[model samples]
Target: MSFEFEKELRVTETNIPGLLVFDLPVHGDNRGWFKENWQRAKMTALGLPDFGPVQNNISFNATKGVTRGIHAEPWDKYISIAAGSIFGAWVDLRPGESFGQVFTTRLDPSRAIYVPRGVGNSFQALEDGTVYTYLVNAHWSLEQKRTYTFVNLADPELDIRWPIPLEESERSEADLHHPMLRDAKPMAPKRTLVTGCNGQLGRAIRQYAEAHGLEGFEYTDIDEFDFSDPNAYDKYDWSLYGTIINAAEYSTELCDDTDNADKAWRVNAQGPALLARVAAEHHIVLVHVSSDAAYGMNKESKTIAPVSLYGQTKAAGDIAVANAPEHYVLRFDAETLQDSEQCAKEVFRLLDEHTAYGIRDFS
Candidate 1:
């Protein structure tokens, strides 16, 4: 029902926010040591999300140098060691200030770690017959999960270190083919067409991407892309941009006007549809940045039902993106919208079919 980890648990905050460590006080006698791993009322009083563990998992590694992990779930987790030790590593996937940052710790029988949602996690066993247990608030979904079993610990971009050398660490088939973080980004295009380049959002994106090593982005302006034009798709060589970020939009306020409604439908709706088609034709993945306004004021709806005309057009665009063969529609709230840096990082993660996108929903 509840876990009281406060009294016996020592909490430590790492560089990454929300990722915490819990150290258990062990009382040892002539026989052995004893510790309480879970306490309900204690943890709840600390104002933390009452982590009602829905699943309990245990992994036993038979020999030393055995490794398992780089996996994360949709819910937060509490991991404890039953025997031996492990080098556990996790990356925050949430789209805020700490996005894409990694944290690593040695977890033994006396320690546990709390992993937040939207994070990439993994670990390695240091000794044979090493066992660890997990208390998670969510269930496992093979189709919709993003945990990697074999990650390149030697990847320069990740810069993660293991107890053993990179060559000594065992790896799985999936890890061997995984792309490096530096090479994993989709914006690595030789030719990228960035719409709305002159606008604030566009300028911010351009600045952030350039600073973050996103090369080959051919930032295009309103002067270039006339999506309403029937020949718009023919004007450019779409092959180079294997990934397209459709950042252009006809603002919601403009769409409210009757005179501008047609402009809105053509640019906001038809424009995105055309982009998706072009991307599909070229076998490229289209990323359409839509407005969360499409959900209207209700953010928890399972379907789109917007009271505003602007939301309606954005929804049309989102639908088009969703219908495309390969695409991702990103709906961002205006007020809480992340800065361009976060957006750039997210775009990179989205492109890496091995990282966040790698977690699929087979079920």
Candidate 2:
């Protein structure tokens, strides 16, 4: 028997963003066949995300008509068949324009698919002992499992044509009871939350995000997310955001009175402390621009002196923000900080560098 497979590996994009299909090279001889199921170096060079897979799982289906899944988990997955063959189906269940997009294909040893987080994955075994193997970037747990978004495999609107009728296919009771596409809750993608949107830095970040065609960002000011108000924490879903850029701060003239100092402390120090606490609990990345007060100060002075009440409060806020494990405390001199546009560019450039947690000076 003459069997043929692709001589080189290649990838194809699907309707869903980040979802990719790979055609692998399979070597065959009389003794059977062998294939490089996953070559990280080569795959990464071919547009594949270097998704640091920490867990690997395998499922064996004993019957030809067995079916499983249609689950959109929180972590990305790279799936392929190790033995036999299967029919695969994927759906974009992430919140956005392509929420209901679907893609279907067949997979053998020579075929693989990269399923981005928030994309549902399912398959039917076309042969007995069909082995489905996948690598996930995150370790699985019961708590994480509850976050999975699921859709019924038999949803008529999805119109997935299963070779074997669902009635004849074996499936878990849970899989059979999933909500339809219309009723299913779309998985929330990691979002960028820009606080103090009306401020110079916040406004700049918003404009930068827009001009650069960045998506999944939400801008908010004191009206929506007053970090100074403890009750404000209850108003928003913090889990939806992966990054929070804090540009909110108290700006007031030098004052010696108790009332003014109290107000400054609450807005500058306490507010950031609260935000940092929440961010730390959620493992969210925090980007805070510490006092831009370097306005007209003598640049030659190397001493760390905060003479004004406002300056002291801003310093306290910076210290509080540094408590978060994943944080970027950015400090800019007067010129750059005042130029919101340039400051925004510098901020984004630092973010693109993926710098570790620490203070960054763009002075």
Candidate 3:
């Protein structure tokens, strides 16, 4: 059978953020047709994120009208057809304004879609021998499977007009049992990890997050998450966080030339550097506080010229934290602050309002 031959490779933005539809070029001749299912460099250049894929998964449908999903998995996926066609339906299941928004389209060997981590994906086989393949950034594990968010495929709220009626289509019993859109909880966004919860700033941030009913934030102190220890980083799943706020620091004034200087360096400089490295590896955003002292007595100074031990260590930490691929080195005057609560509010406000990376002078 002859199919439409080579078209320019392109991508279309769907209603959902980060969800993209791709048009692939297929070259067909007398023998058969061939296509490059995924060309990373070209796709990334076309606004697709360079999400490092670690696993490839495929699903096969033996008969027409077979159907699956409405599942929101924890990992991003680039899905395409290897053979035949499918009627694909996607629903945004992430928290915020787009929740429950739906987009539906038909996919053939010439088309594909990028499903962000929290979007619910479902499809119906429009032809027999349908082979659906996807590449994901994370390797699937039983623990990860437990984090899936699901909604009923036939939920009236979604009101998807399947090419083939779902009643006559093949679906798993588990898929059949999912809750309606109204009843299903929107998948939570990546968690925020707050370090040094015992500290004034940390406590204030914690209180603010709680009072505002912000979910998916884990607050911890040195006892729970000792940044000075490398083993502490290994104990938790780094993928769970989208941001790490490092409030942990040794701000003691008594550390001048004593053994406490080593402790100060470990907590203030080395610890932040280590966290920044981890954040870089996981593609997570790192948020670190830099002292005004790091700039010496000249408040207008942008360069680091510390005159005190505390300032010196903080300057070193600032340099190290800047190494992260995405980071915010927040500099503000603690002495001028009326209260930690006010500082907390501004920190969150800046986080919400700004997408700009690098040093953010809150002062």
Q: Which candidate has the highest lDDT of all? A: 3
Q: Candidate 2, clashing residue pairs?
A: none
RMSD of each: 13.1, 8.6, 3.0
Listed per model in order, the count of residue pairs whose N, CA or C atoms clash below 3 Å is 18, 0, 0
Instruction: Provide TM-scores for the models.
Output: 0.47, 0.62, 0.91
Per-residue CA lDDT of candidate 1, range 286-345, in tens?
777777888887788746877788889888888887766667777777763446556655
- For candidate 1, the clash count comes to 18
lDDT of each: 0.67, 0.81, 0.84
Q: Once superposed on the true structure, which residue ranges of model 1 sit more than 4 Å away at CA?
A: 1-8, 146-151, 183-363
User: Over the full model, what C-alpha lDDT does candidate 3 score relative to the true structure?
Assistant: 0.84
Please give, for residues 1-363, the per-residue lDDT of candidate 2 as tens digits: 122575689999998888999999998876888889999999989988776677899999998999998999987889988888999999999877888999999998889999988999999999999999999876776756767899999999999999989999999989989999999998765678888889878888998999998877988887777788888898766655577888875565433565778777877788888889988766577888875442225336634457677667877887788888778877776466678898788789977776322222222
What's the distance in Å from true for residue 289, model 2? 2.8
